[model samples]
Each structure stands twice: as structure tokens, then as C-alpha cells.
Target: MTQRTPLHPVHLELGARMVDFGGWDMPLAYGSQIEEHHAVRRDAGMFDVSHMCVVDLHGAAVRDLLSRLLANDVGRLKVPGKALYSCMLREDGGVIDDLIAYFIEEGWFRLVVNAGTAVKDLEWIGRHAAQAGVKVAPRRDLAMIAVQGPNARARVVSQMPAVYQERVLALAPFFGVAGGELFVARTGYTGEDGFEVMLPAVQAPTFWLALKAAGVAPCGLGARDTLRLEAGMNLYGNDMDEGVGPLESGLGWTVVLDGERDFIGREALVEQKRRGGLRRLVGLVLEDRGVLRAHQRVLAGEAGEGEITSGGWSPTMERSIALARVPAGTGDRVQVDLRGRLVSARVVKPPFVRHGQVLVNV
Candidate 1:
């Protein structure tokens, strides 16, 4: 049987087009995908992201285990509630998963991983955690709601319990606020300001309805994908997978190799760096009519070939953009083979859009 999130009934009532996303039934869209995407860019939108996995690590060795387990250093998070983005890799230096680690305290840290990779991530963490005497526990009792948009934070705050509202109001970007049974993180896949709130599963409905009453449109995954792509963020499997490393995926900075401390994929990353980054992921903007899509062959002069990782029409910019991996020599002008026809596109740096404005010169 397929799995269901805590908000499944709510989505059904809201007339969402439900689809199976890695076993869990999820909403692809509520109605018009473009309109839902626009709602987030122009106003506020809430997404049912309860399918995401929440794992908690407790005990003295948590920090030590994470530092060795992740490509990024956990010691850098000096303050409580600070979050760090990092990639966990295999012994061969290939990515296991890219995740966010939150430092709540020395003995308590929380990690939010992709739903599809939850089981694998837990297994990976477990395999390494024992070496450092850390306890990795998955928090299945919670549900997550991602409220995104310019007004997302303010709208969510209005409905939070009054006492917790004050603490949430003080949160800075990338920080989390934990009050009572609620945990609000100042983080979002969309470029806009928002929070990923993890609360008791039973409390999700009330909060979901309250946000709706506060004018936050209920968005589905369709809007989420477009927004994040425009924001230049990478989706795990599409942007990079177990076969790819950080250097080519635009996540080199997340790897903190400052110390002699060995990380899982450090040797492979060092070798890749020494080899001069042979291939890389870049953003492309379609100049003509057509949607860019994953695995689409890209041609740049000669016989240079690349593949699009993620692509779609940007509801905010009213154009199409994508992330493509190409040979190191690939340049500005590239052609995408769409439906066996060549479509010209301009290659540019990512973050195609932010704050409701287009970022690249399409």
C-alpha cells in the first residue's frame, strides 16, 4: 500500500491532483500550476511537506559524528538553532544525499532529509554513527509544513500560539526557533522568506487551516519545483546523485576541507579538484518556444554534449530555464535537442529568479 502524509485528507478536500511520490501520495497541483506558482511569488503560499523525514541525534558524540559524517563541519554552528547545509557522501566520494543539519545544542541536533531518501539516509547515518558513539533517531511523530512567500512568515506567526509567536519573530535567516511542541526553521527552498515548521502530527490540521484563513494559498509540489528551480537551488537526484560529486553540482563551498579531519568523500573531491573540474552544471534559458527537460541532450558547437538536470517554464519570469551538466569547455550559447529539433538557449549562472524578479538575462 502507498503511504499518506498527515495532511492527505486536507489536500483531497482542497481538490489537489494526487500522485505517488516515492510511495507517499502527494499533491502535484491544486488547479492551475502556473497560478499556484504565481501566488507564492506575489503573495504567500503553504505546501504540505509532511512527507519529508525528520531525524534527531542526541548525546555527547552527536557533533563529532556529524562532523565526520557530513562534508560540512558541524563545529561551525556556534549558536543554537543555526542550520548548516551539507552533503553526505560514500567512501568513494559520491553523494549519498544533500541535507540540512540544525544545531540545537551540543547533545541534540536535528536533520531534515528528503522523503524519498529517508530510509537510505537513516541507514547511511547509522552505519557511520556507531563509530562515534552517536544515537541517530528518526522523528516519525512530527509533520512538516513549508509556508513560503513574501508574507509567509508573517502569516504563519499570526496563527502560532501567542507565546511562541514572540520567539519565532526573533528568528534570523537559516536559524530555527523551538518552542513547546513546535519547531520553526527560517529556511525554504523558494528564494522568498519563509519557515519549515515541524509540529506534532495531530496539530498539523489546525495549523494548516489557520494558515489558509490567514490568506496563505495552499500550494502543491508543482509550484514548489518551479519556485526552487528559479531560485537556483538543486533537486537531489536531478542536479546530482550518487554518481556525481559536489564540484560539478555547484555545492563545492558546502565542503569544509579546512582541517585534516577526513570526510567520506574528501579524497575523491580532492582528486576531482586537482583534475580541474572537468564538467560542471550550468543554467540555460530557452530563446524559442519549448520546455527544457532532464536528460535532454545539449549541443554547444563541435560535438560537445550535456544533459539537463531540471527544467520547466518559470511561472514568475514567464520563460523556461534549466540546469544542465556539460563538458568543462561548453560556453554561453548552447542548443537543446528538443523533440529531435535543435532549440537555441543561452547559458548563464543559476538563481534564474529571486524575490519575484528574474535574475538572468534571458
Candidate 2:
């Protein structure tokens, strides 16, 4: 049976067009996808991200266990409620999953991982936790909602309890705070200022309704995809997988190689760096009139060939944009083989838009 989130009934009531996403029944769109995308850029919008998995780790050895499991160092998270983005890798240096780790206190941490890879991630962490004497507990009773855009923070804060309102406003980017039954983080997937709130599953429907009443538009997966693509964020299955490492996937910054504290994929990454000549992930803007889509071949005349990992029409930019993997020395101009036609495209850095501003020329 296909899984459904706690807000499945709510989505159905709103007449959402539901689709199967990685084994979960999710809303593709409630109405116009373009409108929803614009609402996030111009105003405020919320997404039911309850499909994400939340796991809490507790034990005296929790920190030690994480030190060996993740590519990014968790030790840097000195302040409470601080979060770190990191990748879990296989022994061969292939990316297993990318996750966010929140440090609550010493010997206690929280991790939010991709829904599709939750089971495998749990098993992987469990195998290592047993030897380290750490306890891994999955928080299935919680629900997540991502409220994004410029007005998102103010709207969410208005719905918070009176006692927590001030604290929520004081939260800095990449930080979270837990009070009562709510954990609000100043983090988001879209390139906008917002909060990702985690609350009890039973409270999700009521909270969704409250946000809706507060004039926050309800956005679906379709808008979410377009927003993330415009933001230059990587999707797990599309951008990177067990076949690719972080270095080639435009995530080299997440890996820490300075110290002697070696992680699972350290050796392989070091060797790959020593060998050099790795393909790189880049942003592409279609100069010709056409839509870009994944699996399309990228043709760099002299540098070499590559493929588009994620591509689509950027609603914010009003243009087609994509994230492609190309040869390291690939120049600015390239051609995309779209449906047997060679169309010219410009290769630019990722992030076509951020904070409602167009970062790249259209």
C-alpha cells in the first residue's frame, strides 16, 4: 500500500492533485502550480513536508557515533539548537543521503533525513550505533510544515503561542528552538526567509488550517520542485545517488578534510581529490525557446559531454533553467540536445534566483 502523510485528508479536502512520490501519496498541485510558485516568491506559502523522517539520538556516545558517520563535522555545532547540513556516504564515497543535524544538547541530537531513504538510513545508523552504545529513535509521531517566502516568518510567528512568539522572532538563520510541543527552525528549502515547524502529528491539521486562515497559500510538490530548482538546490535521486560522490555533485563544501578525524568516506574522497579530473555540477539557462528536462544530453564541443540532472521552467525567472553535470573545464556556452534538436544554452553558476531577486541574467 502507498503511504500517506498525516495531512493527506486535508489535501484531499482542498482538491489537490495527488501523485506518487517515492512511494508516498503526495499533492502535486492544489490549483495553478505557477501561481503557487509565485505566491512563495511574492508572498507566503506552506508545504506539508510530513513525509520527511525525523530521528532523535540519545546516549553518551552519540557525538562519537556521528563523528564517524557524517561528512561534515558536528563538533562545530557548539550552540544549542544549531543545525548542520551533511552527507552520509558509503564506503566507496558515494552519497547515501543528505541530512540536517540539530544539536540540542550534549549526548542528544536530532536528524531529519529524506523520506525515501529513511529505512536504509535507520539501518545504517543502527549498525554503527550498536557498537557505539547510542540509542536511535525515529520520531514518527511528528509532522513537518515548511512555510516559505519573505512574509513567511511573520505569518508563522503570528500563529505561535504568546509565550513562544518572542523566542521565535529572535531565532537566527540555521537555528531552531523547542518549546512546549513545537520546534521551529529558521530554515527552508526555497531560497527565501522562513521557518520549518515540527509539531505533534495530531496538531498538523489544525495548524494547517490556521496558516491557511492567516493567508498563507497552500503549495504542493509541483511548485516545491520549481522553487527548489530555481534556488539551485539538489534533489537526491536526480542530482546525486550511490553512483556519485559529493565532490562531483557540487557539494564539496559540505565535506571537511582538514583534521585527522576520518569519517566513513574520507579515504575515497582524498584519493579522488589527489587524482583530480572530476566532472562538476553547474547551472544552465536555455537561450532558445524550449523547456529543459532531466536526462537531456549536454554538449560541450571540446570539453566533453554531460547530462542534465534536474531541469524545468523557473516560475520566478520566467525562463527555463537546469542543473547539469558537465566536464570540469566546460566553458560558458554549450548546446543541449532536446528532442533531436541542438539548442544553445548558457552555463552559469547555480542559484538562478534568491530572496526574490534574479541572480543570473535571463
Candidate 3:
């Protein structure tokens, strides 16, 4: 059976185009995907991200267990509500999932993981938690809403309770604050500044309505995908999956390989690093008059061949862009095989756009 979020009725009432995302029925777009995308980039827009899973951990062993489970070191998250992005890996170095870990307080931590991998992620954490005697509680009773854009923060702040408004505004980037039933985080997947608010599932509808009345456009998955792609953020399954490691997925920075942390996949990554000659993920700007799509073959001349992991038209740049896994020494230029015809492209760093500004040359 397909799952529906708390705000499903609201989405239906708004005439959003719905599709099955993973096992949940999610909105693909409210109307025009391009218009919704622009709303998020230029003004305030909100996304119903309640399908994402939130898990809270407790007990003295929580930190220790996380230290061994994730590729990134959680010891860095000392201050309360500080969050860190990390990847959980298999023993063989393959990425199991990417998640955000928040240090709520001593002996307590919160994690927000991708909806598609929640079940397996819980099972994986449970298996490890049992040994360490850590308590793992999934917060399925919560709903998440991501409000993003240049004006996103101000709009959300106005809707928040007066008592909590000041604290929410004082929250630094990558931090979260909990008050009553609300947990507002100064973090978002979109490159624009915003807040990701987690509240009781029952309150989601009213909150969604309030934000809509406040002039926040209701965006859906289609716009979300384009926005994150332009921001150079990686989608769990599309950019990196169980078959690939972080090093090759342009997520090497998220992995803490220094010292003797002894996390999962440490030895494998160490060995791979020593072996060298690893393929890398690179950003590509289409120079030819063709659209770039995933699974397209990329020709890097003598350097070798590669494949596009994620590709589409960048609305901000008004050009086609892609993230491709290419040979280590690939040059600045390459060719993408689009419909049997080789189309020229330029290799650049990720982040084709940010804060409504095009970062790359069109």
C-alpha cells in the first residue's frame, strides 16, 4: 500500500500532480515545474518533506555507537543542536545512506534520513544499537516542511509562535532548536537560506495552510530535484548508492579518514586511497544544443569513458547541466553521447547555481 503524508489532502486540494515516490504518494508539481522551481530560487517556497524519517537516539552508548557506524566523526558536534552531514557505509566501503546527525544534548541525538532508505536504515541501526544498548526511536509522529529561498526565513519566522520567534531567528546555520512540539532547523537541501521545521503530524495541515496564506508557494518533487541539482547537492539513489563509495561520488569531504576512528568501511577506503587511480564525480555544462540525461555515456578521449549520474536542464542557467562519474585525469572538455551523436561539454566543479545566482558561465 502506498503511504500518504499528513498534508496529502492539502496537496490534492491544491491540484498538485501526484506520483509514487519510493512507496509514498508525493506531489511531483503543483502546476508548472519551472515556475515552482523559480519560486524557490527567487522567493519563498515550501516543500512537503514529511516522508523523510526522523530517528532519536538515547543512552550513554549513543555517541560511541555513532562513532563506529558513520563515516564522519560525530565527536565534532559538541554544542547543542549542532548538525553534521555524514554517510553510513557498509564494511566494504559502499555508501549505505547519507544522513544528517544533530546533537540535541548529552546522550541524545537526532537523525533525519532519506525516506526510501528509512526501513533498512532503521534495521541497520537497530542491529548495531542492540549490541551497544542504545535506544533507537523513530519519530514517525512528526511531519517535516522545508521552506526555502531568499525570503524563506522571514516568512517562516513570522508564522512561528512569538515566544520561539527570537530563538528561531538566533539559530545559526546547521543548528536546530526544539520548543514544545516544534523542532526548527536552520538547514535545508536547497542552496537558498531557509528553515526545515519538524512538528507533530496532526499540525502539518494547519501549518501548510498558514504558509500558503503567507504567500509561500507550494513546490513539489520536480522543483525540489531541479533546485537541489542546481545547488550541487546529491540525491541518495541517483548520485550515490550501495554500489558506489563516497570517494567516487564527490562526497569525500564528508568522510573522516584521519586518525584511528575505526568506523565502518574505514579499512576499505584506506586501501582504495592507497591504491589511487579512482574515478571522480564532476559537474558538466552542455556546450551542444542537446539535453543531458542520466545513463548517457561520456567520452573523455584517451582519459577513458564515464556515465552521467544525474542530468537535466538547469532552469537557473538556462542550459543543460549534469553530474557525471568520469576517469580520474579527465580533461576540462568531454563529449556526451546523446542519441548516438557525440555532443561537446565542459567539465567544471559542482554547484551550477546558488542563492538565485548562476555560479557557472552560461
Model 3 segments more than 4 A misplaced: none
Residues 1-362, candidate 1, lDDT per residue (tens digit)? 78898899999999999988867999999999888898899899999888889999988888888878899988889999999999998877788898999999779999999888999999989877877778888988899999988999899999988888888988999999788778999998989889999999998988899899989999999889999999999999889889998888888879988879787888888888887836878999999997998889999776388899999898777778999988888888999999899999999998998888888886
Candidate 2 RMSD computed on C-alpha atoms after optimal superposition onto the true structure: 0.7
- Whichever of 1 and 3 has more TM-score, that candidate is 3
Please give the range of 10 consecutive residues that has the lowest summed lDDT in model 2: 180-189
Clashing residue pairs for model 3: none
C-alpha lDDT score of every prediction, in listed order: 0.89, 0.94, 0.94
Candidate 2 lDDT tens digits, 212-322: 999999999999999999999899989999899999999999999898987999999999999999999999999998899999999998999999999999988787999
lDDT of 1: 0.89
Query: In model 2, which regions exceed 4 Å deviation?
Result: none
Q: What is the C-alpha local distance difference test score of candidate 2?
A: 0.94
TM-score of each: 0.98, 0.99, 0.99
Per-candidate RMSD, Å: 1.1, 0.7, 0.8
RMSD of 1: 1.1
Score candidate 2 by TM-score against the native: 0.99
